[model samples]
Target: PKTVLLLFASGKLVCTGAKSEEMVYESIVKIHGVLEDYDLLFKDE
Candidate 1:
């Protein structure tokens, strides 16, 4: 299943519909990596 991601201006990520906590965390890490590639990651909190 595909998860829904909500990225805010404050660099806060809201991931929904993940089957498990581990999946959510994994997705967040991937998303952060993508953002970092573009030099858009300001915080990881």
Candidate 2:
């Protein structure tokens, strides 16, 4: 099953419904990659 992500207005995130800690990390990484692919994430100079 896919994990659920709860994003807050304050820039906080909550990952839930994952089978393990590793799964949560993986999910977040995947999400980050997608955000980068779409230029949705800010890059630090």
Candidate 3:
């Protein structure tokens, strides 16, 4: 129940072995924070 590829809308993917949905969401939030901290976020829709 680990090591899988997550496909996204932009043809991007994230490989992870997260055990639970909460952990997955937490990882996503952490990555988002890192991107925001570096100003690497989209400006508009």
Candidate 4:
């Protein structure tokens, strides 16, 4: 199943319909990592 993740420009990350904390955390970390790889993660601007 594909997890639904929402990334906002306001620095809010939303993980929806995850059955467990591990799932949510994993999704968040994975997305965060990919974004970081592309230098698209949040910045302190």
Per-residue error (Å), model 2, residue 17? 0.6
lDDT per residue (tens digit) for residues 1-45 in model 3: 334556576747585888888777777777778778999776556
lDDT of each: 0.81, 0.85, 0.70, 0.81
Tell me the TM-score of model 3. 0.62
- Residue-by-residue lDDT tens digits, candidate 1, 1-45: 367889988766789999999889888888778888999756465
Kindly report which residue pairs in candidate 4 clash with one another: none
Lowest summed lDDT across 10 adjacent residues in model 1 is found at: 36-45
Best by lDDT: 2
Model 3, residue 26: C-alpha shift (Å):
0.3
Query: Candidate 3 lDDT (Cα, whole model)?
Result: 0.70
Which candidate, 3 or 4, has the higher lDDT? 4
Global Cα lDDT for candidate 2: 0.85
Candidate scoring better on TM-score of 1 and 3: 1
TM-score head-to-head 3 vs 4, winner: 4
User: How well does each candidate superpose onto the true structure, as a TM-score?
Assistant: 0.74, 0.76, 0.62, 0.77
Backbone N/Cα/C clashes per model: 0, 0, 0, 0
Candidate 2: segments with Cα more than 4 A from true spot = 43-45
